[model samples]
Target: MRVETVLLKDYTTLGVGGPAKLWTVETPEDLKRATEAPYRILGNGSNLLVSDQGVKERVIRLGGVFQTYDLRGWVGAGALLPLLVKEAAEAGLSGLEGLLGIPAQVGGAVKMNAGTRFGEMADALEAVEVFHGGRFEVFRPEELGFGYRTSRLPEGGIVTRVRLRLKERPKEEIQRRLQEVDQARKGQPKKKSAGCAFKNPPGQSAGRLIDQLGLKGLRVGGAMVSLEHGNFIVNLGNARFEEVMALVRRIQEEVPLELEWEVWA
Candidate 1:
């Protein structure tokens, strides 16, 4: 197999990290073989934070073969989430429109039950095909034990594909909805960021709470909280992971003391 060292900054949306050991797998066999050694499966690297010293573990990245999309049936795990949603919408399939601007791969999205106002990926998932241990198995939505931002697959299990059942909708309606989501996302600040930094706690929004506490546009080094939306911490270029982490910690500390609401990381 091929192996290389890569700057995590180049792979992650935050654009801030050091080097990481990387391996790319194009087939299930390759994945199984790679898993014989210790490794972590990575998607588009949208929601993860690599340490300042970089990831100490080998990172397995699925390639184009695993990224395939079959709108009529199931989609491969490596498929880009936004691309899958776009393809499904263009094919007149409903249920993934609300995920329009979210950056992640199908495998990562499914693992986290990614969703928006319309609904989550779990809502459309019919079954999941996974490679675990040395064998493959299929799991229905109930069997997958889907919950908020988590799934049942064991820590090292690799998701191969997912069968989604989407409703048939008018293409025009689908396009309009996607456009609306896009418009809403565009209204947010444009900068280098890791999307949302923390999950909303209980019934309250992390953004609103952070904003209410007057943390908007707050800065630590080059990392700053987005003025457009408080929950997002944007990189103003030349920002480092340590700086971002420091800002995150500051938010966690200040918000609770100032507003009496605990924000999670």
Candidate 2:
């Protein structure tokens, strides 16, 4: 186990935020020991935007043994999503290909029910092993209450491992699906961002709504809305957390449609 005062920007994709007390746990025992107090479980930090004032809660990150996985569809919480997708493909697995380019870990993906239009993590999730309430327990899909861009995984529950049941598909077919997912993402901006800044409202696309409002290319300090995809807010240079939230607030206040925040701050 390791603990240090680390800048939140270094852990997040947005490259902004203040310092935090980070705890890196390499073993299950370390995880148990670190859970004695209130803490936040951070995965790949892909869909997070920390405040410039920083967080008071200690941040826990899984590592070492937690990063290992196997072909039978057993994956650790720290296992990168893209790497798991590649491994699943090589093993003739199919359900995870649609999430090819997502920058998240297995635990985070499962918690958020992360997915594209084609599929979601829930489609492949068989069981989840989480360390919570001072004990480890396995939860079935029905227990998660999966829904659009969300899951009810209990507030303090820390997902440790996940079991997936992917369909056996021809490697060629799986590769083609992955290629299509990659191709679809080409239209999105390739800049420093926490993926989509806003969640798609029911029966409507957030990008389309923002585009319809002519809000693309909007800027606040060093943060700006991506012209490529209106749903994305990019960090041009030294973006601040307040600036990003300011832009988000502007959109929410000005736009008639209610825009839900996707990035956790």
Q: Which candidate is the best by lDDT?
A: 2
Q: What would you estimate as the lDDT of candidate 2?
A: 0.86
Q: Which stretches of candidate 2 lie over 4 Å from their true place?
A: 256-265
Which number leads on TM-score?
2
What CA RMSD would candidate 2 show?
1.5
Which residue pairs collide in model 2, if any?
Answer: none
lDDT of 2 by residue, 119-207 (tens): 88898888999888988899999898999878988768988998888889899999899888888878888889988877787788888
Estimate the lDDT of model 1.
0.79
CA lDDT scores, all candidates in order: 0.79, 0.86
Clashes of each: 0, 0
Can you give the TM-score per candidate against the true fold? 0.92, 0.96
lDDT of 1 by residue, 133-210 (tens): 788889888988887666788656788898887889999999998888888767566898877777767788878888
Candidate 2, residue 60: the lDDT equals: 95
